[model samples]
Target: MRILLLGAYGFIGLAVARRLQQAGHDIVGFGRDLDLGQRLAPDLTWTGTDLSRLSSEASWQPYLDGIDAVVNAAGALQDGARDQLAASQQRAISALIAACEARGIRTFIQISVPGADPAAKIAFLRTKGEADSALQRSALDWIILKPGLVIGANAYGGTALLRMIAAFPLVQVLAFGKSRVQTVAVDDLADAVDACLAGEVPKRATFDLLAAEPHTLRDLILKLRRWLGLPTPTATFDLPAPMASGLARLADLAGWFGWRSPLRSSALDILSRGIVGDPTPWREATGRDLVELDVLLSRLPSTRQERIFARSQLVLPGLVLTLASFWLLSGLIGLWQWREAVAILPPSISHGLAASFVILGSLADIAIGIGFLFRRWLIRAALAAIAVSLVYLAAGTVLAPSLWGDPLGPLVKILPATALAVAVMAIAEER
Candidate 1:
């Protein structure tokens, strides 16, 4: 089939694209990032198209001229007041369904969430349900697959969160810890879509996709920890609902900067309701069971990449925050205690030069602290921090070597901090 796959570089989109390509289907990939689309399907043509830009009145006439089917997999966790979720899941979907109807293209595949309902209070699920209803209302031969928690080899938002939590050294704490979810392997979901396209499964139907087994959120996380070869958590604690909600609120604040938290308010709301689906239809349609979590885990790549990601997840934040706090405080100390800071300098270093050092060094530290929060430029920030540390180390050694042997080990600590900065720099690259 000549398919136009939206969100072609996303976690689900990548898996679906690969499965379709492996099955020898022609996939015309569309996504927010054309480079990512090209990377995901190097052999295919890619169009940089943001579904969030699509509107009900927009014309997508010619885009579907040669497409035999359309797969809508694009999504976002939070809208961030941008209305991006509605744009992608509702308006854009309605537009596409209408256009496909005009062109007499019947096959439409919708990747939906497990608990989506048009009447639901949650905007995410409501938007999904609205689109699902649209597809069903249209004359197109639509297939809707609503999967529960999707666990794939690739570590993305939710997957990354799972690994990061599982990698915790000891006690595992969470909110909504007892919520049950049935996870579906991304590959299995991809295969199901492929089967539907091949007419092996019914068209104009909806199926709830999930594995045979169900697990509580806590058990699921522990299972992942075991899969990663991490020791089982010594204990698991569910934070009070109020505390969890507070954290989610903080996450929402982070969303203002385009940084999404998998544990945001909307996400916590969804988790509280549980991520679950009936799997009987999926099994009956496929005539086989989906891959077990253990099997999927074993098939996943557990190499240096995962280990590094897990380790970095555990340490990178502490390193950045510690450095930020230290630098910001150090600058304050220098500025607030100008005389003490300057007095430590050699007599050859005039008071004017010493004041300049105190002011500029403090400002530099503050700037680097701010830079650590931006992922796009995080590597450069870490490198800049390392440079500053080395400069401080070298200058301190030359200026007053006595500080190196100080009881607090203030100067010696820079050596390790520099090393950590290097590590953070290595892991901060866009993955």
Candidate 2:
């Protein structure tokens, strides 16, 4: 089969594309970042396509040509600076379905969630439900596979959140700890999709692809901790619902700046409601049960790299925010006490030159801080911070070498800040 795989660069999509390719299918990958998709899977052809822009049947027609099947693995948690929920999930899906029908491409596989409903309070689920309905009503051989919290070897989305929680040292802190969640291994999901394409599963049917039993969110976290070879927590702190919601709202606000924090309100709402679905339909059809969470974890690689990734994700947000605040406040304070700032320079430099230098440096600091706050500019911000820190260190050495020996150690402090900027740049790449 020649398959057009949407979101082929994403966590799940990439896994599925590999599975289909291993099964001897020609895969054409579609994603907003064609460069990333190509880099991830160089063997496959890739097209830079944004589903949010494919809001009409005509817009989707060109992609359907010579396509034997279409697997939609793209999705967004909520509307953000880079995401449009209704447009991407609902309108684009409807348009694609219509185009598929017109182009005589009958096989369409939709990857959805467990409790998607058009009338659901959460926009993510509602949009998914609307798209699922549109596909059901169309004249194509559609298969809806709604997987529960997907557990994959690669950490992303809910999986990333789980790893972050598990990485906490000695004490476990949680929100919605008791919410029940069923999980499907990423490999199982890929296999199920392959089964659908192979006509091993029923056509035009909805199947919940998950393990037979469910685990509480707390249990899942502990399992992940064990998987990562982390020590057991000495204590557990289950945050109150109100506090959890407050944090989620803050994360939601961060979304506007293009940070796709997993703790956003949409994610919280779904997790609190519980992630579950009947796995019997898929099992009955395929005569194979999905692996249990423990088994899934055991089968996956548990190496130093995995542990580093989990711990890095847990510390990343705090690190970024702290760095931004440090730079921002430093600049603000420099501007607020212009005379004091100028006085820090040696008597050899004139007052006018000192004042001008202070102003320019503060403005540069402010720019770096502002850049750090925006996700799109994070890498550039880190780079700028490092460059400016070097410049500051060199200038301080030249103008006020005595400050290096002072108790405050102003010049000494720049070393750690510059090192931090390097660290942020190292781990900033989302993919």
- Per residue, candidate 2 scores C-alpha lDDT tens digits across 104-168 of 99999999999998999899999999999999999999999999999888978888988988899
Give the lowest summed-lDDT range of ten residues in model 2. Answer: 43-52
Question: Which stretches of model 1 miss by more than 4 angstroms?
Answer: 37-41, 56-66, 81-83, 102-104, 286-288, 298-308, 338-343, 347-354, 391-411, 429-431
What lDDT is obtained when candidate 1 is compared to the true structure? 0.80
- Give the number of the best model, judged by lDDT: 2
TM-score of candidate 1 versus the correct structure, residues matched by position: 0.86
Candidate achieving the largest TM-score: 2
lDDT of 2 at 239: 89
Could you tally the backbone clashes for each prediction? 0, 0
Error of 1 at 159 (Å): 2.9
> How high is the CA lDDT of each candidate model?
0.80, 0.91
